[model samples]
Target: MSTAQLQYQSQSVAKPYFIAAIGLFVGQVLFGLIMGLQYVWGDFLFPEIPFNVARMVHTNLLIVWLLFGFMGAAYYLVPEEAERELHSPKLALALFWIFLTAGVLTIIGYLAVPYATLAKITGNDILPTMGREFLEQPTITKIGIVIVALGFLYNIGLTVLSGRKTVINVVLLTGLVGLAVMFLFSFYNPENLVLDKYFWWWVVHLWVEGVWELILGAILAFVLIKTTGVDREVIDKWLYVIIAAALITGIIGTGHHYYWIGTPSYWQWLGGIFSALEPIPFFMMTIFAFNMVFKRRKQHPNKATVLWAMGTGVMAFLGAGVWGFMHTLAPVNYYTHGTQITAAHGHMAFYGAYAMIVLTIISYAMPKLRGIGTAMNDRAQIVEMWSFWLMTVAMVFITLFLTAAGVLQVWLQRYQPNPMPFMAAQDQVAIFYWFRELSGVVFTLGLLLYILSFFIKGKQPAAQPTAA
Candidate 1:
């Protein structure tokens, strides 16, 4: 084993966070399935679970689980990178329970009562932060979130500062701090819808496209360093270049959202050009991952993690980069705005860039958490690999079907000489909707199998290569 593989046990503080993350991930997929079914059946859950409510659960869970994953990643890696114990393990655990409790109560509020009722009970009337797309959480819940984020930052910040500072820890801390800062924008709700949306993108677009990429890059670099036995110098250098590109392109790319929100006419060109450049970093990431793998000094035992890391690069490029470019042009977006095409890009981008990276870190770390060596047995790994392909392929089909549905709807309802009404146009795309729903089912099955992989026990074998 390499010296780097002797990672300190202080990372154990991350275990509960990862467990909670996987549990919430299951909830996210289930709610997503509900939303997919609602698209086709419309009355699948009806009054008990309306499309809007289900959609809220689906999106919010994604956000929460990803946050959980990031927290876990930070807890797991920061201590090792800094060469010390966490500043306060008890504080990390306390924050975990607090965050999990708050998240559960908030989701229950979404599900158990009417949204209006939730707003009133949660004291949204004190401040109006509800009813917006992603900012639909009540003001009180938003406050809880802010408090949790601050506690998290304090815990991580002290740990990073107390020991040897590495490029990975510094980048992760910066990303996490930016996340908390930007989220403050969510508390700012203006009466003017235009201004509301402008700042809203500061939190929404900037988080995913900006600081979140920094978190993603840092985590990936840490994993690559541990897994590939690559020189930290090389990985550290690449991390700087990628994050620099991400911020340079992503901050200005917020203009794309401003274009339709009545910001200004000139934003169209600005949005088009800068948003077009947003994909460059993702493409660079793909090249970076494979290059590191081929130059590996030692083959890691955790093959699943390697697959996930490589997949992140490829899928992120296809979903976030290529698909995003498809409609980022001012002309194309003018037609496809708010269509299923946007949803298609979203599903792929989130899963590819964020979800896959979380799984990558979890896959690498969980075996150690379980007292196993560096990975699960070969049989479990094979099952995990199968689940990976199933989920990835299913997502691809879902995106294609939705993209087709969006195109058909645009033609029938917008581009036709005599356009059909919205509802009427929907009927024409029903087939695609059904296809998308079926693809979602496949994704769920894969998720279930992924869960089952943890329980399937086998002989402890050294890591073996699945490819030449």
Candidate 2:
């Protein structure tokens, strides 16, 4: 086989993963719309698909799909960065099927059975790892995840160790390892709520705010380097700075979640100060992306990828940095915690930082994976860009509407001289929920267009020659 064919065979492992991620993404957004409507209608899907069930599915789908994206990204980029084919393409493909099967079965179990029944059937009674938000996967499913992750890391790790080492693959591997390690805490549920919650942040806050940012930075840096023709040295420098800042702040920033969760008082100040600094890395990422793009040596034909790259920077800053800082301080968070404001931050931060980064990688890699040149045709690019703006604008509106609802919820439920009842407060915020649901509709449309762009045909560009 020629060098080009060998490279294609190596990278081809990523195509199914990307496809699965996008497919799951659509499911997540659909469930999100269902949950949004439930906020106002109160019984929109009721027993058939209760608000809690919809929420669990929505959140779980988000995590699962993003994991797929991350894995797909690693598979797509690691070999190239290492200057070799994968250590074991067969292992990567096998793990993909295993992970996907486990994920799909878990989701089916959630929707098909009652929570308690699912727990019983899945042997959660023996392990007791279910019931936590985002960690709601059954004990069996969690075990499957761990096994899949181990196999995955072994495959990627061997490839990276055997080939040339770059800062990108190294940092990415570090993050993936941390992700798997932190997830072990899900099985550490204690009878003490305080302890349970504390360790839970190890899995949740640490993943998103901590190591996952490492993954985000590495992926963004790789995309920027490819799209902008920037020197790896320059991008590597930014990656180091961003990763250091993200870890320094994000690890300690876990304190922010500790403030009211029966932790020590010192956490109030420690969490507040450190979490406040968390935005620095995201802000740095924004500058890093634009600077690299502005300094590009050549214009890559993948305009949609570049757009997603730039958008990831700006939006991650706005969502994760600015909006997150909006609530990181203990005093402000005291009022905003658990309110729609929290939802606003969660929605945008996840979208801006993780979801967009994943999509950015897919945008950059999918064309090449499909042998369709470095990008989609002009018409598809236009459609994809339209999807980008539509989804982004819709998300902004969703966040804003949720923020409005949150503020009102705070005032009526917490800030007022005489607080209203919880359900009463929810009733008062119904209008904002209506608006949020509408924004969700727009988001769904954007997602559909995004999916459509994949299939839309146009004049084909010459496939770029691949290398070994």
Supply candidate 2's per-residue lDDT for 132: 93
Off by over 4 Å in 2: 1-8, 461-468
After the best TM-score superposition of candidate 2, give how far the Cα of residue 289 lies from its true spot, in angstroms: 0.5
lDDT of 1 at 174: 99
For all predicted structures, in order, the TM-scores are 0.97, 0.97
lDDT of 1: 0.90
Worst 10 residues of 1 by lDDT: 1-10
lDDT of 2 at 397: 96
Across 145-186, the per-residue lDDT of candidate 2 in tens digits comes to 999999999999998999889999999999999999999998
lDDT of 2 at 40: 82
Model 1: per-residue Cα lDDT at residue 215: 98
Error of 1 at 17 (Å): 1.0
Residue lDDT tens for model 1, 265-293: 89898888999999999998999899999
Candidate 2, overall lDDT?
0.92
